[model samples]
Target chain A: MASKPPVTPAFSLAIDAMGGDAAPEVVLDGLELAAERHPEGRFLLLGDEARVGAALARRKRAARICSVRHAPDTIPGDMKPTAALRIRGSSMRLAIDAVAAGEAAGVVSAGNTGALMALAKIVLKTLPELDRPALAAIGPSARGDVVMLDLGANVQCDARNLVEFAVMGDAFARAVLGLTTPSIGLLNVGSEELKGDDRVRAAAETLRDSHLGANFRGFIEGHDITAGTVDVVVTDGFTGNVALKTGEGALKLMRDLLRQVFTSSVPARLGYLLARPALDRLREWMDPRRYNGAILIGLRGVVVKSHGGTDALGFAHAVDVAMDMVTHGFNESIRDGMAKLATQSRALPV
Target chain B: MASKPPVTPAFSLAIDAMGGDAAPEVVLDGLELAAERHPEGRFLLLGDEARVGAALARRKRAARICSVRHAPDTIPGDMKPTAALRIRGSSMRLAIDAVAAGEAAGVVSAGNTGALMALAKIVLKTLPELDRPALAAIGPSARGDVVMLDLGANVQCDARNLVEFAVMGDAFARAVLGLTTPSIGLLNVGSEELKGDDRVRAAAETLRDSHLGANFRGFIEGHDITAGTVDVVVTDGFTGNVALKTGEGALKLMRDLLRQVFTSSVPARLGYLLARPALDRLREWMDPRRYNGAILIGLRGVVVKSHGGTDALGFAHAVDVAMDMVTHGFNESIRDGMAKLATQSRALPV
Candidate 1:
């Protein structure tokens, strides 16, 4: 059973200041940046008061509307979600608690993804219209930035789940990416209509006939992701996770190979110095920091997970994503989209 | 019904001369390279006799060991596999025909992948011990070269199919990659035993207790593919295909970005000139031609597919791969492994 979540005035956000690899500093610095953009927003900072309070006081803007909550414990990055869930004193859990308790509209964390997801689900519960919450993130493509969903949420999803993902992703793009109408594509082995399994085929059929049919671009292959064949790429958790990791791995490999090439000889080392500026520009364009936020959509409260290893800028980008989801009524949009989808499913044997 | 392919003297290979984007030129030039390596090798060239014969006559070494089959019709690269199967006069079909007629031990083609797979399956059939034939390829990783299988072969694989893939991948690693005892990992969303679909979990269970259990590394996540945590990464075709394409796409994206940076300014251009030699070495190490061969594993006959977009050097690598498989008695090894797997399954309730 799935239903849309109630619309909430998500003006305040809870922060897990002890989350990320950089921890309290990244959170404090990120909040300062976020505060500059959302002057009216309030933040409930969860972590050690002594640590975050000293840092928060230094950031004028972040300190103005932020309140530091005493959370003595910090969840280890490698800690299992089940173990983390039992530790209520952890900053991650405390931050999520703020959202559940209506102190904040959403919670942002740069901690263990598994623990975050598990804790968020148990506390916030899923939206009325979702069987499970999905993780959605933005990635660069040849054309532009593209939105991909179900990064590692549900390992197994039926056709219905895919259709639901398309709805959530469309709303997400509209909100964060600011696309008026984003083209949707179902990731598969081939772009041909006859290709893929029954679940993928069925999902394609539903999307094609649904209200979002105008933006549905049918099947797309792996290369199509970077090719930017569509604005939103949707697939089950397993394939999506593998694809994401594989893409990351390839990029790292090339980066390493490039590094090796640049340091191989004295001539090459000099060449690297000359090429530093242009390469820096290229690096900025492809920076993982710019796309650090991964939203857990379809949850009762907004949840954005930042990369655990990211610095202040990356954590700030994640904050921006969460704020956008809250301010733009991202959940409400999903509700409306899902309502239409439900009507369509009822009208046809989808 | 799965049975081992009959062992034959595989000293000769059939060549689809007019297959690649460069057609007879890449084929003939590639044969010249293969001939240099295998002096006793025989090649039956299938293409327009005048074109292939004229080119063959120019290459002294290739001319000595090659026989032109006069296959005038060249299959279009974009032609459907079903359509290709009906075209008996086509060069791609003729090459397979020579292998079927026992004139050649195996067939190599840089033709339409779908057409080749379809035609090969229809003519040669699956091995006695397998439910389906899989496509396997080698790719670079952090540690070294790694083998991944079922790359768009079976979209929906069961537990049995996954287990079978492990056996085939193990044999492939030993035969083509020349690994003594390759560590195999089942591609999953997470490495935890509790994660993934039932089929994946079941496959992991069987592999954990099989004869290859010592080398079986349980489950591996997507990043592990590039991290080289295992020697062979095995998964269903759909996921494998997507992961491979994603990795390729990422690499291409980085390459394009690097090119843009290199040409951005006068200084960058000068730097590129200085770095050209070292960059060239890096390019050679990561060349597509070096890893051009994608074998159609579990087939009754040795069939290797080359990238249609590749050049002569790449095509030669495919020939080299086919020759290696033949020399190593790959299919026989798979049979022996499967036989042990069968006995183990019989002994236990796998």
Candidate 2:
């Protein structure tokens, strides 16, 4: 088992209160829930003072643990990542800045994903020896939760970039999912070694010969993602993004089809009521809110991006991920893993 | 509506009778079903004479319409495409050769995808002005069926390749799905034109300015596949293959979860009985057999590859697709579309 990091009470997380669809209200509600879940956790809430102050008025318990800072502007959902970088007074930027300034251990936002990635990359920068940061998220699988990475952080990636993603994904599964030594697999069209593009083949070869080869499962197909064939699924951003969305689309289609089936007749409606408890359990198990957070890994500090359309519960889950990262010292583990990889790559007879 | 090709009785489809998991038996059963569906359709069955003759004896109806040929060899599923290319007496190769020799309009096989592609490419070759063939399949969607390609035909595709895929996918959707001016969307990480890699962006630009621009729907995310946001989704083989398999995985996962939900308690069990009819309908709607065939588009002749593990019903659906392609003159439509694209591309300012 990987050694657990020391529990630290000094870690605080920054929240972009005016980020998601519901904005300050959803953020405050989520903060209250998170605060209740983790009594020792502290929060720095950045947003319009009046709006945040009004929302906080109802959550005295959460307000006691959160310190609010006034930010005059907001980053629009449609704003490009480059344009978002110039908005200094925006709540999203200010919240991320808190982490960069060491006022907080991590940052959580439900803002535009591209903007969040850009601002976090600029503010916290990447870890030493890492060329780019990857967005990692946990997805529900048949056996358990699966960690997948590079979910649109870098559109096009090379062999070395994929290797880096594998390392970061491995550390992430260990840190957040509490896996001891997670099996990692490079996502490809087929499990066969000769089935994919040149970049994938080279990355697979590197992983096979690396020190982490014992835990590396080689190439895994798309079905393997939900089959829980591997603990960590690493791929380039474009493919990862598409796979993630495609899975989401399939689940949505299933839900819609089920709804249609149950509402088709009176007997089906009765069955729905009778099976309500079991169906509810199934729904909760597959709830998007339960798997809400997507972390920008390889960053100097932890940054979590929640789905912009998600509600309070989803935002709270994002906070849980951020807290887990900060408490577990995710970045430290990644640094150690990278150092080991660097040595292993150099030790190879060139 | 797109003009339907004149239905000609001269169209006969060739079957690789020694392919699939339950070869000869499943092939005969599927042929029986297809013969009943298309009373006027003729079939050329190619396989080992003894085995195929034995299966054909029990399938009198299919045997009446099929003319059996003695192909002594069978291509093993694990054989490489290149190795399979040299086996001239193999059932798979013979079935494809029948199309080249003008004995059949198209060929259908539930065999090794790689070998089928390679053999078909060698025998039937590619259509004029088309560099490579692509695998195109129809997937169930919220609005109906959506045509997507290339499902592992080319691992790495350039901007020109993507544009070609868009053209082929557009034609396939129109021919098989019976859509007039089917809207086309290039699969990407984001819906924005500037969001994806150079190839995707370049393809989008070409599609936007070409003769097919009016029917082009711009970039679509993975979720858009099942959402039925567009009629045709064009992508590189690697991405398309991953997306297709990911979707299949998600559907299987949903089915497993539903089974657990419906059998958890006595009430749920009773609910299952009450909802059986509706659930059955839902199952029929999403049945794999209903959308079995995946056509290798851009080839000189139509070639359909069924899932190797699928049963007789699935194989029948594959034959159904081949029959549709032949009767609808799918290749002719593709040739016309490519000619139009070539003319438009030449007229553009370099």
* lDDT of each residue in B1-350, candidate 2, tens digit only: 01234344344788999999889899899999998998888998899998898889888789789888999899999999999999999999999888877778889999888899988887888876677889989999999999999989899898888888888888788778889889999999988767899889888888888878999999999999999999999999999999999999999999999999999999999999999999999999999988998899887677999988888899989998888888887878877877888777443212
Model 1 docking grade: high
- Which runs in model 2 stand beyond 4 Å of their true positions? A1-11, A345-350, B1-11, B345-350
User: For all the candidates, what are their Cα RMSDs to the real structure?
Assistant: 2.5, 3.5
lDDT for each residue of candidate 1 in A164-226, tens digit (9 for 90 to 100): 999999999999989999999999999999999999998999899999999999999998898
Residue B138, candidate 1: Cα error in Å is 1.2
Error (Å) of candidate 2 at residue A57 is 3.8
Q: Look at candidate 2 and give me any clashing residue pairs.
A: none
Q: What is the TM-score of each candidate against the true structure?
A: 0.95, 0.95
Interface-residue RMSD per candidate?
A: 0.8, 0.6
**Just chain B of model 2: what TM-score?**
0.94
